[model samples]
Target: MRLALVTGASRGIGRATALKLAQQGYRVAVNYRKRAQEAQQVVAAIREQGGDAFAVQADIADEAQVMALFQRLDEEDKPLGVLVNNAGILFTQCRVEDLSAERLQRVFATNVTGAFLCCREAVKRMATQHGGLGGAIINVSSAASRLGAPGEYVDYAASKGAMDALTKGLSLEVAAQGIRVNSVRPGFIYTEMHADGGEPGRVDRVAAMAGAIPMGRGGEAEEIAEAIVWLASEAASYVTGTFIDAAGGR
Candidate 1:
């Protein structure tokens, strides 16, 4: 089975995607930063379902750590076929003017730089030019990039916007090399990430407001995982440099 690595897989959409991919016959590498136990739980769950998975630890924001992460993947001797750049960081809600450089760096370091590092490694292994089979890259972005997250985390939104740009450019750069890059932009999904933004019920709060979400509800991590998995599957063989907005018509 091809190996699928999902960063930040200890929880939320990453965890959901890891589990779903395992069910689809991929050996999952559940990557986490400080959530070893949670990551192990995901691996355990996959095993319970007769699937293959293992937890890997690394801080995607650090260059050395990222290198080590891929080295660990090499020890498994599985040619990585799918890289889900789902690890990201967002600060508490703050207006752009109130945002600090430290916060911006922290956000981008993980959300943008970390993803680029992973893409670099994935391409090296998956590019046909590198004498390996082709593969797919799925970047987990946010609808906030387009929405701007005004009066909230504009910095986080900007970081995701950068991610979108990276997805498009990298897709074109490696398309002919047997690599396909795509992104899934999720909107107002109910996850622990909201708590990071200082609002545990942020999705519900937004959904409660009329017209905030056209679906009159928030989405689930599993729903986002579906979009992500589809983008990585053979079903999307001809799809690249594109986005799947699983935002409930928003």
Candidate 2:
């Protein structure tokens, strides 16, 4: 069976993606940093639905833990066929000039460095010609990367911008080797991260602002998960290095 490794699968888009991939017939390795209970719940839900899934705990920012995650997958005879680098942290809204060094580093550690490390390990095992099997990597970025997030969260935007660049460069570098890299930039999805950011009502606010868009609403986690599932599937065999914007016209 094909295996999918999804970081930050405890909740929100990551959880939704894990469930979606399982539904698509991929045995899922659900990765979570701290919310062990929530992670286990995701696993339970998948099994209840008659899907194959297992929860693996790891802080994606730590290289050793990320390496061990893959090692465990190897031991299970479930070499990764798809990787969703969805584990990320968002800082409280702060202006660029007022950002703290600690806060900045923390964001980068989880949002940027974590994705890099996971992608590195995944590529090591996913290179078409060298690795046993060719696979796909889907980075969950944000539309804020393009919007710049202005007075709200420039640091978060910058980190996702870095992810966007990585997706493009890695896609070109590994396409010939049968590994496709792409990003799903969701615009204003309601997730736990927003609550952590001190604005649990942000999604409602965004929905009001979304009046300018044709769709007239914020995107849903399941909608974004659907796009991610498609990008990781064979249906997107010819697609790579592209950003699928799931923003409702944002």
Compose the digit string of candidate 1's lDDT tens values, residues 1-250: 8899999999999999999999999999999999999999999999999999999999999999999999998898779999999999887898888988899999999999999999999999999999879999999998989989899989988999999999999999999999999999999998898898889989888899988899999999999999999999999999999999888777
Provide the overall lDDT of each model, using Cα atoms, as 2-decimal numbers: 0.94, 0.91
- How far residue 115's Cα lies from its native spot in candidate 2, in Å, is 0.7
Number of the predicted model whose TM-score against the real structure is largest = 1
Worst 10 residues of 1 by lDDT: 90-99
Q: List pairs with backbone clashes in candidate 2.
A: none
RMSD of each: 0.6, 1.1
Off by over 4 Å in 1: none
Highest-scoring model, lDDT:
1
